[model samples]
Target chain A: MEDNQKKYTELANRIYDLDGAVYECVGSSLGRTFTGGRERTVRTLSMLMYTKPDGHLLRSELALISNMARTIKNKEEKSRMMTEYNEILMEIEKLPDVFGKVDILDDERVRLNLAAKREKLSENDHLVICISRTQGSAGNDIGFELADNLKINYYDVEIFDQVMKRLEADKDAVNDAENFVDFNKYTKKSGGSLKTRFREFNRYHGLPKQDAVFFNMSDLICNLAKTEDCIIMGRCADMILKNNHIPHISLFISAPFSVRVEHIMAVRNMNLKQAVRFLKKMDRQHRKYYQFYTGEKWGKPENYDLCINSANYGIKETIDVIRRMIGK
Target chain B: MEDNQKKYTELANRIYDLDGAVYECVGSSLGRTFTGGRERTVRTLSMLMYTKPDGHLLRSELALISNMARTIKNKEEKSRMMTEYNEILMEIEKLPDVFGKVDILDDERVRLNLAAKREKLSENDHLVICISRTQGSAGNDIGFELADNLKINYYDVEIFDQVMKRLEADKDAVNDAENFVDFNKYTKKSGGSLKTRFREFNRYHGLPKQDAVFFNMSDLICNLAKTEDCIIMGRCADMILKNNHIPHISLFISAPFSVRVEHIMAVRNMNLKQAVRFLKKMDRQHRKYYQFYTGEKWGKPENYDLCINSANYGIKETIDVIRRMIGK
Candidate 1:
């Protein structure tokens, strides 16, 4: 265990150094826009390192970091660093699972806390708005302002932290849920044919670890929607609530690809090329993430109730349009 | 020549018969939505037959008609029709081009008409708005209203007629223009590098017959923009004006796929499934057409100055937003 901990610590520290070096090299030349790439990877890896240190995530991160490192001008040094990271990855694959089985249902404390919170909430007549948006479409800004106008709690990254906490406390919960299929419950809720219900069950069972996080995150979103009138941004919340038969106004905010690239360039002080690359990468990630869990095309108009082009109306008018939509 | 005329007339009549029968069968059952399908195909084929009996277009139309006919309930009848069409297609492939070459440059009448029209117009400080929209987004309605409010000429299908008239008068004009590659003229106009200019020249040279029609349509749009203020709908007019350095505001109108589907169902009296299928088909066609002509992604925000989700703000509010955008 001590040896594993040392190996993990050394790998984490190296990732930190490489991240800083890449940032210092590229960020200085390209301004601040390039910081999000390697820097974000390191940040995410660090969070995982501190929490779970899942082998699959670490391997993927190492691969990404090595790819980014190859872009550096010093080819010889980067190649050497990549070789070292590959060796570390191989070693990580051999390491035994550090986390033991967690009995989620037997945890009285978590259940009690959830029950107490549920008891205090009104749980009825609560308005929920799920806004899915493209990168740099000012979706977050619109969501925040809309939340303010309606005097409601806005959940964005906060929901991620909540899900993460739950996951840390009950690592086996998701695995158990995947193993346990409630066909009757699903069929009753979906009103789908037995074949479709079976397909849905298989989809739930086959979810990857990362996508399972989305599953848990979706549960948290459903809970939050029930507790209060709040605005949820991204995370396939719209589909989640709809599947749960919750009444909510779902909005998809997008702008032209060029408009989004320009918006990112302006906000992040990125050059045009950098902005375009960043937006493309982020858009692909968002699309894949949304599609993996929902089994629907991302940004397709039919999925959402209202689709708004933020560039058409800007921030203020966009909010006004939504306000009018919900009659708030 | 008389033999070719008889063959073309016979083929056209067969297409009309097949189209009517298909419509009479499908339209009666599916309501009005499916009427636009094979019926529109027949109408386009009839127009082409009357104006320019281009063998390439005739072959494609036969292929389309035969494919549509295959969908008919009477498989044996449809297969017989398909076999007959295939034989006609073979005959079309062998027919010599009957149309005489037209001298586009020495046409004094056309030049004089265009010159007279140009003279009648203000020719300066006119607002030209080009709108590109997805199907069922009420883009045509918005363009008409915007034109009405601004009191500008709205050109939609009218532009197609104008282009067709010019093409019929001078069949060789497009071919001549494609062959006459003035490198200096292109370089000076584009201010692109020699390599890019050579590539652009190749793109122009390699345009298919159908896309070459777009090239002529673009020329007409440019001429109209210079002569007077007008709102041009579709036909990649936005890129056309931008290429000519003609100042114009381009807008792309779209709605959520579901919203647009519902709109079509309501207006066309189509069922839910039929509306969804129609919108998807139209969207794919528009995207392909736009990309072929302009080499730009259709309905991309950056391509247009504004992209309005008309569902957010119905027809009236959408027009009002555009009015505000242009400060009209």
Candidate 2:
């Protein structure tokens, strides 16, 4: 719990630092222009990070503004601009204090409801949690915390890695299968001549290497479920468990794109552009991978017993909810 | 389509006007306190609307700031504040244009992809679309637009309104049934002394008036489904149709909480606090209503054929996807 609090504080400080940089840029820009408001400042910053092709403010753009400002040769105007700049700097200095207050507000909003103590359970008790999360929603962190709290084994990408290793499989095989499946889908959609299409379909997915990997992975997951209580993350574990008639709580965690972009930017120390690109790519890959294997939509609520927004309800609070659910 | 464009333009203008007011207030406030920056301006505006109990900025707060400004007696300091005030007002004057740019960005974001011309279908073509949406997700608008585009009838609140009128029912009875069901849920959760709880449950519901109303509403919806191709919205219509084994597409539409709040605030002409309150209440009411009838979690993906985010993909693109699905 103390570690959790420390992590949050660290995150809060990171946000403060980023917001500080943005606040300074906005203040300086406004000081120079004397023609834009707070909304314009935020919009510019957001656009630079979220919508700009490069996903960040171009230094060239800043330099261009500076060049324009330098061209204003009137001595009086230049002196006035300096005064405005000084005033803006003074305001920028106070931003940390304002952000401190905002941090407190966010803390209040995210306070986790700790679970009550539960009765002792026998070793044979059946409990499995399959948690799937969108990229940048901190699914891994939540999975770890929930597992630690529940005193259960946690499996994530490492499990998939170990299984692939055991099978002596190449990862690219999965990509090939995914690509083949995707091509099949497009061809099916386009509708070619019947005989040609039937031949193509038969040749397309004849138990490809990726399907072998998934089959092996599902068997591994089912074997794990039968052995002990555990929290499994991703790799279509939920669908596999469901097919095996394993009664378990399936959970999907997601956040808004904006929130996720912010999270990835902060956590990964990536600029806005990189973060957006990374998250979008990951989401698409996960969706395609899940859909290809299960023939079901990824992150669809019906596939999961619980669908939650970790960004809306804080991760700790979400875990708390899950704890209560497990108890029931 | 032209009317839709007009409405969006009007909404953008409304946002511009509101932002103008906020800009003025922020400008004047900043002029008084040279220690504040863009972050402070936005935080203050957000707090005034979203956190304040009255859901708006109080006149008294503005007056107090004025009074404090009047008390500052230093000539240089006073003159400096006035200069800052003038500069801020100058910036405020340029806000409409800034907002115009943002509006265009938003417009680009929400642009709908109109569907390709679809083939004509027979009257008994077995096409029913049941759409359930989060409050303020513009579900009703989407439903109406989808129905119009498909040249099918749309049923929403009016259907429930008609059903209630025919049954000579009041809305509170519905609320009571929801409450009774919620209580029964608690009793079940508690696993109370079985005999007493069973008797209490039997005596409590006993074919309540609200259930009668629901029965009629369900009948009305099912009859409508039998008649023609149509889109049904809300009042657990999706669940009702599903129970009746109606062949249809069930869709669930959702948006991020902040997006939904903004939608309600703008469209309902409510302050941020009021909008948030109203949406939360409506969501709770809906969850209870749906759970009471279906004994299923509202907004679960399994209950629907397609789950979408209007905020993510825009309403028009969502409609386009639905159209393609229906055609297939």
Candidate 3:
């Protein structure tokens, strides 16, 4: 990371004005901003275009800035940093520029054919989207809305219910106060069933039972990957779909504490104290669920293909940005 | 949480249009705004007043808006929320007329307070900060120039060094990589020195080495804190100084993956790959250390007094906002 920073800082120092350029980069991102500025002005413009609604930046942009902002002395090293930064952008603009070095993908089963993935892409191309979010992070609003906008089969939690029904039919999975525990604990005699094992795992982790009423929101989100294109929320699908890269886009949405509190307060009309209680509870539960399932902390930013401040760039714009990224 | 939300929503609906005749009941919260405008316009204006940044309202015009904003059915609840939003601010704000019974602290703790800790403030203040970032998130840059305007001290850290030193001072007391075989192992050791136990706990979780340097950076930061106010990049000082809630305001700065990546690329001059790598590596270390010490997800908005989107707010304003938040 330090080495990375050195590269960026050196580049940052070279650019006298950042306000113009940053905006131009952003303009390119959204398309058709008022242009007619030199590179110097465009450079500084980027600094002025200084906001993302939910906080977090795109991976490609991060590379450019990190290299640009680095602290460096040796001109050779500085040039090398610039080269590396450029290579990354050019690679992301289409891929194959990086050759076949697949990074950020951990799944051993994934077959990499970057070109194939690219060729298959279309405005209507299907995708497996994993949205891992904080509890009460308004992920449902974004996820469901995204599916609605995409005009594909939308599934917030209904998908999990369907899966659970199939999984439980084989076994006498009953729902009770300890529904999750019982379901997770028991299965058919022949290794029970996947649902039973999952139920047992859920029981182990104290997850809600996979009843018609008790759903696995996370699993529902991940199953979208197996299907064609779908938007799933808060289930670490990015990591799950790691092997099948390309069409996969991950997003982490968050907002400032005050803004979130205000939204909760206004929407729910909860007094401040109650709002705090609810927000904390949801955040904690989501964190636990994330940790339990992924063995990794949620909202860590690094875990996702994208981390968006739902409050900043917002849900609709975020979707638009992703659409643009996929060049759809 | 839902229940609380329902209650708040119900009350907010009622207060949505308080009549001008009910001025006495509403108190000074809606003074002039209620006097002349149509009730609908007044309500819309009231909502806008709260939502928009206080610039077009103007300094002189703010008095009326402030009055209208202050009008509330539940002063106690509002005060409590206000404190939570800006603990230091409530400590010093002109308490609302119905501040009593709100559990608002009169005898507030007087430890080191930050300029950023102040509430309802928007003045520019110079700040020095330290940061502990995740591997794939460009969190270090916020710390990079946070001290650009500060007069006193600054220490930026990728790894927490002070805690490492504490671990090193007592190697037997601390676990040194070899002790644990599983990733889930965590210390719940009690009846020992808090410092020693924390080290033992971090060891089981595969946290960075005790002498990784972030902990020492924290020590240096805290030492800096002992004298003047600074924006701490990271280090579980909020947890470490749990008792001393006043003076120092701990801020967890983050952005979504894509945003941060973009930020790293532009700011650090890194290629996409290196930026992603840098963000992930540094962020993971920080999260591990943070969760290990704090027993809370590091970047949860609630854990920190202020959680800002460096991408949303931009680095300079984030620093400015922090300065204002801490009331530096």
True contacts kept of each: 0.03, 0.03, 0.01
What local lDDT score does residue B254 receive in model 3, on the 0 to 100 scale?
60
Q: Is the docking of candidate 3 incorrect, acceptable, medium or high quality?
A: incorrect
lDDT of every predicted structure (CA atoms) = 0.57, 0.52, 0.43
**CAPRI-style quality class for the chain A–B interface of candidate 2:** incorrect
lDDT of 3 at B190: 19
> Which pairs of residues have clashing backbones in candidate 1?
A256-B301, A301-B256, A301-B257, A302-B257, A302-B258
Question: Which ten-residue region of model 2 chain B has the weakest summed lDDT?
Answer: B99-108
Judged by DockQ cut-offs, the docking class of candidate 1 is incorrect
In terms of TM-score, the best-performing candidate is: 1
Please write out the lDDT profile of model 3 over residues A179-216, one tens digit for every residue.
Answer: 32233323353255678767775653564334332334
* TM-score of each prediction: 0.42, 0.33, 0.35
Better candidate by TM-score, 1 or 2: 1
Instruction: After the best TM-score superposition of candidate 3, give how far the Cα of residue A211 lies from its true spot, in angstroms.
Output: 13
Give DockQ for candidates 1 onward, in order: 0.02, 0.02, 0.02
| Candidate 1, A222-248: lDDT as tens digits | 887777777788878878877786656
